[model samples]
Target: MQKNPGAKTIEGDLEEALFHAGAVPEQDRGCPKRFDWARSARTDKGVSAVGQVVSGRFYVDPPGLVQRLNSILPPQIRIFGYKRVTASFNAKKFCDRRRYVYLIPVFALDPSCHRDRESVLASLGSENELVKCLECSERGRKVEGIMGKRNFDSKIGLDVGKLESGISSNNQDAGTTEEKIKDFSLGANNGGFDIEKTEEDEVLVQDVNQEEVKAIKKSDFRYGEEERERFNRVLQYYQGTHNFHNFTTRTKAEDPAARRYIISFDAKTTVNVEGIEFVKCEVIGQSFMLHQIRKMIGLAVAIMRNIAPESLIETAFRQDVDINVPMAPEVGLYLDECFFSSYNQKWKDSHEELSMQTYAEEAEDFKMQYIYSHIASTEHKEGVVALWLHSLNYRNYPDLRFINNNVNNDVESLGIEAKDGEK
Candidate 1:
């Protein structure tokens, strides 16, 4: 239901599709159509959900209703289970906490720093190198726009320079090859395009270029022990109450609503998918600000890669810093689970008990067929993350204020809260 578009042309997400499928004809259906349809979490576009809950009222609640709903809806959108809740239930407010898992390819963290790894690891955030990486990328993009993209190699104070000269030269950046074609993509390689001429390419990601392309492969993108330890420590900082005003846009730093409670955040090197390994990050919290999770991961990756200092994360939490945080690719993020502790406790005590549990086996099957398959294919073939990295440089990493690349902007004319509510 999360990644798949609904059947109706009006609204295309799971929630919208469910409402349509559950909806009965106005005249024949009881009650006032679908009343109080609420979702536990509003997953962003392209995000998959294993445990998502929704509650609403229909005129009739007959036996096999769940089956009927699935029969009517798309197979990609399945109802794992359903529960009856009290009249006081408010899916948005009453819920206690939400948990999410973001699975990024381990290669994204591949130190891009070759032999100088020792020095880079020693001083992860020594001199704000990440700013250099971002700013340099910004300069390249601006040059590409103003000047011909042919001369897009804008490399001043690029963090990749920190690498050993030998390793730096041998490791050509894949992005440079993308510049040749009008539509740039990492997956666009091996498509009968002659990249042999693009070999002398400079300005790899963060101004890194590998002379020996075969020396590094997608499998080569990985995190070392030192990078893993430091990333985990940085993740710990995400917990507890903090002002994430900079993580999102439009909200003022002084606004009390900007303060959010994070219970825990952790990450580890995992090779869950075939031929690819990535840091699997999970964060649990009462709620998150818009684009909060993506930005958090982006900053962490920058620090881990030794492109930026660890202090950037701290400054982001502070109200005084006017930092427009950069976001990692949204393709890697997923809404893993949502918890309703208080609601479940109350229901247990009362005469009625709500079945808020999920069917894990079935849920896993659905995700593999519909969700993970798309992510893997897109990552391997289409180069979603690569395109997103390029996008970070778009508009010079402008403020992440309500940009919905997933839903067609054309739908905005229809007006159904396009990309509204939840990060």
Candidate 2:
């Protein structure tokens, strides 16, 4: 469903591979075929899935079916094994819940990693470079006097004037030099960034496009303990049922499908990949629309980076406020697993449990070498997250400005504040 030119999708690739393996007859390969293929979840083009389940009618005449499929399928995709299920089984319809994981470099959420470069760019009047990284919709409406530097009421929480002054004073001593500019574009940290890279991971640095590589070398950005904790807090905002019309496309607030229940959304742990530290954020929900996971991650990251206020998220769930939330890159997102506990329980006596636990180790290895490595390598080269952060600052969504200027009223109207004794 996620389009990538000249690439093979799991659905398309599996359909063809089955044909080659003699499981799908040549006649069934055409559009008006007798068999139907269905997957538990739809993944984006670049997104990887280690525990995806697909159901289809297959002819299991001969032995070595799994071996034959593997031999014909590409290396990137492999079938661990299969089990015969009931005739009424439908992968998507019977799935109870879905889990997803997103891998993000430490620097993406650490403001200190980007602060100095942002200051340098501002000083050089080259801030436009950051604004042009992505296409964002202008909200058109503006709050009167919100654009001017003003002291925010302390009762509402964040002090805008003081926050601005603090950042300015801290960076006042930061000097712009030709070398620093060069290093800024290349994301080199001068002993400040704390991440380490392996020798093989370092190879991606060479031959990177000068234009694309022109970013604050973020490797030096230290994603300390405090920063990680704060980011986790930011992620907790999406942990309940909410209208997520803004998080995906072609959906309106009034649409019943826009309402989704999130079981848990949290930053579970950090993993070292090719010397770069990536935080693994896992999300569990009953169902998700297209781009829902990516947009949720994007809004959370934007809030963490201070490009958007925390209240913007609450406002997005309001039916009247339609904010164009950004979608995070698909490279880091993957379908971790799907659950069918209810179905399995009812048929415990007959059918084997439909689960990926048997192949968990192989799945982890595939995700590490193929999925995680590709994410790290691509991020190190393209700096997609870094560029996206810059764009968020310039996007100027009306809801962001509205909430910033009227935090108290916004919170009161939305009723997002916790009831007494709730937290």
lDDT of 1 by residue, 1-423 (tens): 222233221113333433454433444333322465555666555455666655555422334444554555445555555444577675666668887778876656654422122333454566722112221133222112111112334342212111000000011111111111110000000001112222233334433355333223223444678767877998998889999987887888789988999999998646455444556799999988778898888877666654555655664665654566768866666666667788778778652333323355665565555555555554653344543444443144433333333332343332222232211
Name model 2 segments beyond 4 Å from true. Answer: 1-7, 115-224, 395-398, 402-423
lDDT of 1: 0.51
lDDT of 2 by residue, 47-164 (tens): 6676677676776546666667666755656676666667777777888999989998776786534333333356455543441111111211111111113222212111111100
Give per-model CA RMSD: 16.7, 18.0
User: Could you tell me the lDDT of residue 340 within candidate 2?
Assistant: 83
Specify the highest-lDDT model's number: 2
